[model samples]
Target: MLNPQWLRSFAALIEQGSFTRCAEYLDLTQAAVSQHVQKLEERLGPLLIRRPRQLELTPAGHALLEYCEEVSAADQRLNKRLSEHDDKHGEISLICPGSIGLALYPMLLNLQQTNPGLIVRQRFAPDKEVLEGVLENRFELGLATLKPDDPRLLVSRFTEEPLELIAPVSERVEGWEDLKRIGFIDHPDGRAMSSRLLSRYFPEAPGIGSLPCHGFTNQIGLILEPVARGLGFTVLPRSARLAFQRPESIQVIEGPRLVEDTLWLIHRAEWPLSTRAKLVVKTLKAQIEGLSLRNHACRRA
Candidate 1:
């Protein structure tokens, strides 16, 4: 019989594509991941992985990945059911992009005050990780801007936010001509998001309208500090823009806007929401929707 643990380790190896990387995910030594794969292959009596190559799966390995995904999903459903009936809402984990976490996490914290007993674990990750985590049941809920795939992962878009242009108050101008005068404050990933959004909004615009984009920071909040000091301007989603406390010094320009990005609430479609999970999502929607209105008010005020 193939060891289930070894199968799981092999799954990790497939995901990481190398023993060294799998070691980090499983918190196991590189030798251990290799040994687990070796044990798995021995039990099967043939080569599972095409070695001397970078973790290419043989036909057997391909068959095994499908089996593991099904088993892993079932195992998670069983665990969730057991936890639900135990009167332990226990820990409900939700993973989302860092931008959503900034705008919506307070609502999660506020939920604790209402129940006083439910445990909420909010994990911040990028968009792709968040979606995959939801699909794999690594998290009960996830928020992301995704391409929208899979019936198992039900996604409900909550809002679409436009990107706002910002420049230093000192260099603030009312038009696009002024936007071109100073260098643009480009957040590495933020620029990519903006580029995609712009392409989406204006497919026939003039030659992609070049801007001097620079600066690499993973944190969107950090981008504002330099913008406030007149460094340069960048386009960021409205949700991320609200996180910055300083609004007066930084000018939000109307010349160019980013394509709206979708914020979807996701959960497993096959499983009913846990009582606590239902409550959390309810609270989240109300909070986020309410904030959307308030944000509009603030912008218009």
Candidate 2:
């Protein structure tokens, strides 16, 4: 490998137009600058034409100068990218369950709007897919209902999302019998969430599968549509229920037992999060906390 100092001296000699001037610019002795040129020629050969009162470049010298220019350009680009990476700017990729995505997507968009430099990329996925995305390096952050036990992950409790039993405003639900009469509007997590909440509230009630299926939808935004139209009842996370467009059309069934699902925030433990991703995580946590407080206040009222 050629020495970088020698290349620097050679380039500087050409730019300064003389050995004496190159030595002055580089804070080196004239003998040192000349020696650099000598070493370079010994390694590559015939780099310059020593003309009195003028300096001229050989073909080899021209090639080396071009290589030096390319290296300089690449260095500049690397520095620019590093600067952007350290700032609160650039893309932040995250994957989360559909329920949280419904609530968090709008908040993420609002954050991007305020910051202008941030580009948010969010995906709606199940817990399995969320974990996979983070582990595979497709996402910088992930939110899951279950805490991952993988040692490769760094997990923390982000927030708790309550599971709400919802039915049309016109429907009256007083007991398990009422739910059975209405039938079940099932979604991807309908059975799981219903099982958890119903088992706690009505210990005598059968499993969620016992209820006749009224309708089904996998879309988080549309999960409450059938319930809102008085078709049936369903259980969902509070975030999903709140994101429904026609909130007045449906009601959350109040019960003695309250069930909440713990949401976990996850990222790879091997690599630290970028500045933009850390900012996004911090902003999301703050917003969700504020929203949770507001909901608590409303429930108390």
Q: For this target, which candidate reaches the highest lDDT against the unseen true structure?
A: 2
lDDT of 1 by residue, 123-165 (tens): 8788878878888888888887765677887778766766666
Clashes of 1: 1
Q: TM-scores across all candidates? A: 0.65, 0.73
The C-alpha local distance difference test score for the whole of candidate 2 amounts to 0.90
lDDT of 1 at 94: 89
User: What is each predicted model's overall lDDT from 0 to 1?
Assistant: 0.73, 0.90
Q: Which residue pairs in candidate 2 collide? A: none
- Could you say which candidate leads in TM-score? 2
Give lDDT: candidate 2, residue 259: 98
**lDDT score for candidate 1 against the true structure:** 0.73
